[model samples]
Target: MSQERRNFDKEFKLMTVELSKSRESIQELAKELGIRAELIYRWRPEYLEKPEGSFTGHGKPRHTPEEAEIARLKKQLRDVEMERDILKKGHQHLLQGRREIYRFIACQSSRFPVDKMCEVLKVSRSGYYSSLKGTVSKRAKENQELLSLIKQEHKKSRQRYGSPRISQALRANQVQVSRPRVARLMKQAQIKARMVKRFRVSTDSK
Candidate 1:
């Protein structure tokens, strides 16, 4: 009778070689694994010659260090470009909406391009540069001047001026502004006028 040939996979061959390394004799391990001892001896030299790719299954190439580094850098570049494009939308879908376009641009400019942000947000690049140089907008400058006047008026009135009085004083000085605006500014500045309490005296019979 003729004996049929047996085919062993890479994993089986590797395990057989590792088991042969033990104190157990090759014949003993081969007998236990039901594989011929001569076949195990032949697989051992092949594994030792190239251990890195020895046990890899068929049709799959081992990834070299250079290829892995290139893949990682490609992924990083793709992510950065994606974020840059997302921040360059001219629509009002950005954070804080179109009302605070400059504010949103300022926040996102740290990561993306500031020129792209300004162009997308429909703001002049020069204005953004001026803002970076510590130049305040017209409204902000006006508010600062109004705040100084409010502080002075509040002090002159002995800290007794509320929003209504402050508004009256501002109008009296020909500085036209709404009462609610004054109140809002005062609230933002955390400025509160001292409230005058009425004196109460009780007359008791002696």
Candidate 2:
């Protein structure tokens, strides 16, 4: 048979499944449609001889327990990794947003104009105000106060102690808080105090 005929036969098998499954015989349908019975008979055997596990796109796939578990674990792992990346990005965005906010405020009150700052920062006033609502409560104020104490200690220990070291210093002073929180406050204050500019010392003995 030609490839085209074979493909047509497969489609004919699919289209004729319901009619084939009915009680009426292929010979009866051939007589009713005035066509050859051989065409129907040829495909009928192919349909009957189909493997038990084969599907015709009518229902959900049946999976083994291990396969299902493996799929579920893979999806869960993907979701968790996505969440971690989102958290990291959010932290970085928050820090950058804080810097922009500081510049905005500084411009409005100091040398830079608010409108000019807005243009330079490439952020709208609404977004700037929204970030201002980072925390709002007495507890939040207390957290800021605790953060200031940590900063004081951090400065005393070493001006360049990043959030992690500041968190350690907080622990040593009996102030309990997470490193993430320390990092947040440091970001908010924009206090990256230790800033040593790198330069190659030219010790050429000429």
Candidate 3:
């Protein structure tokens, strides 16, 4: 009885070629992968020369020029659509702070690729990954505590107090905080003081 010949897919061939570049011994890699060393040696040059067109199995038809052009256009369309979706969902965050942008990316990470989101949002990939670790600095913790207090005081005043009044009110309670910092936090939290209309005892002349 004759033994059937083994067949390798394009992915496997490409992976083998990539492994061959980093590996010290092609023979060792081939032995581990259960293939002949000559296969890696043959795949390397072909992959290096035309990576996209390489290792299209023996019977498979090669892509025509029109097909290749269509493939390229389809890729471009997909990329454009991805960017449009990202922007449509995350446009508001773009106008806000970097932390807000990071939060948006983290929230939308399930829908889109993190690296692509980072690229589209103009934020560093390392920063986005670091945000994933959920590390809050001492100052940030302090600010959060201060913001809580500010919210309480603002509500107590019935939204009639701005940052300066809030700062004075905080100090009266023995909480040492700056007005500018209060203003910034208020801006971030969208806390605004309501304007009071004063009554004037004046009659209109007819």
Candidate 4:
């Protein structure tokens, strides 16, 4: 005995097409819907091109010439997007580069893909993972030290010292660092100088 194929209604097809507009991947939606991924892809353009006229019955799509062109362009756009995603994953492979740069890129991996950074930075995905597991870079370590000193000095002065004064103070202790560098670190650490207000005297005579 052979089981017959299940047929979905027009509304179901239209709803499936709508769901594909989300960030969810087509494979994920197909798995959730218990249907093949290709079916969703196939139905999307047809339904999008002619929402009311599509899936009226049988596999026929009623589309005008303009609608047909629009559907073709949409398909082309999807193809281009796919290509761009692929390129982004493997941009320029640079082998002997700074680890700090990779770390910065890795920090943004939640917004951007790690594979993209790995490709662009010329680091292997495995190398990128290993770098993440490793200790902080020397420059970052120094920045932390400077930031701590900056905080201490900032508080000692009642937060009245901006980068220029802070640089002189650091030099007094033989720190020998640049004011601009101190300023950049302070910015990153969210350290702001406290603004002092001048005292004003008011007198009233009657």
Choose the strongest candidate by TM-score. 3
- Against the reference, the lDDT scores of all candidates come to 0.77, 0.62, 0.89, 0.79
Per-candidate count of clashing residue pairs (backbone under 3 Å)? 0, 1, 0, 2
lDDT of 4 by residue, 104-206 (tens): 5665677666765555455678766766788566787898899999999999999999999999999999998999999999987889999999999999998
How much is 1 displaced in model 3, in angstroms? 26
Model 1 stretches with alpha carbons more than 4 Å out: 1-107, 119-124, 203-206
Best candidate, lDDT: 3
TM-scores of the models, in the given order? 0.46, 0.30, 0.48, 0.45
Count of clashes in candidate 2: 1
lDDT of 3 by residue, 15-107 (tens): 888788888999999999999898788888877767778778651436779989999999999999999999999999999978899999989
Q: Clash pairs of candidate 1?
A: none
* Shift of residue 85 alpha carbon in model 4, Å: 1.9
Higher-ranked by lDDT: 1 or 3: 3
Prediction 2 TM-score vs. true? 0.30
lDDT of 4: 0.79
The superposed Cα distance between candidate 2 and the true structure at residue 67, in angstroms, equals 58
- Which 10 consecutive residues of model 4 have the lowest summed lDDT? 89-98
The residue pairs in collision within model 2 are: 107-112
Query: What is the RMSD, in Å, between candidate 2 and the native fold over all Cα?
Result: 18.6
Per-residue lDDT of candidate 2, residues 1-206 (tens digit): 65433224334445565576784687787676555678667656555666342234431234569979999999999766654544443434445655445444543445444444444445666655555675355766787698779768767867877888888878887888898988877887777758667998898798
User: Which window of ten consecutive residues has the lowest lDDT sum in model 3?
Assistant: 55-64
